[model samples]
Target: MPAKKPFALRLDEKMMQAVEKWAADEFRSTNGQIEWLIHEALKKAGRLKDTKEGGRMKDEG
Candidate 1:
């Protein structure tokens, strides 16, 4: 596991509640859920450098 850095996020109450609910449903802490979301976004944008497999973005031909 890599080291995690802590930071502050100022989400409004509604947004925070939604995130908390999502985290609970997923059996993850709110921080873990947010980390997963960011990682997925970066992977979708071709910004991830360490993909274990190279053919993930290929068409299913």
Candidate 2:
């Protein structure tokens, strides 16, 4: 596992609401959904690293 970084995130009211709804729909915590969204965005930008424990790169497809 990689070292985790801590930082602050500021979301506008509407954006936060949308994320909350999406998180509920996906049965994931809001923080988890945010992490997933960040990971996905990074992957799309070719900035995400691959993991050995079955975590594949998004672009591998």
Candidate 3:
């Protein structure tokens, strides 16, 4: 697994509630759901590059 950096995130109460509910429905932790959402968005936007190990590669450039 790649190293993960932690950061503070502030969300509206309603949005946080919605994300919590969605995470529960998907059997994922709220943090995991957020990460998945971001990863999916990056993939859709062609911002992620797949590696031979089937993992995402970070653009260090």
Compared with the true structure, what per-residue lDDT tens digits does model 2 show for residues 1-61?
5698888999999999999999999999999999889878987887866643567543455
Q: Candidate 3: where are CA atoms >4 Å away?
A: 52-61
How close to the true structure is residue 34 of candidate 2, measured as C-alpha lDDT? Answer: 97
Candidate 1 lDDT over residue span 1-61, tens digit each: 5698888989999998998899999999999898888877887887867545476643212
Cα lDDT listed for each candidate: 0.79, 0.84, 0.85
- For TM-score, the strongest prediction is 3
TM-score per candidate, chains pooled: 0.73, 0.73, 0.81
Q: How many residue pairs clash (N, CA or C atoms closer than 3 angstroms) in each of the candidate models, in the order given? A: 0, 0, 0
Model 1 spans > 4 angstroms off: 53-61
The TM-score between candidate 2 and the true structure equals: 0.73
Between candidates 1 and 3, the lDDT winner: 3
Number of clashes in model 2? 0
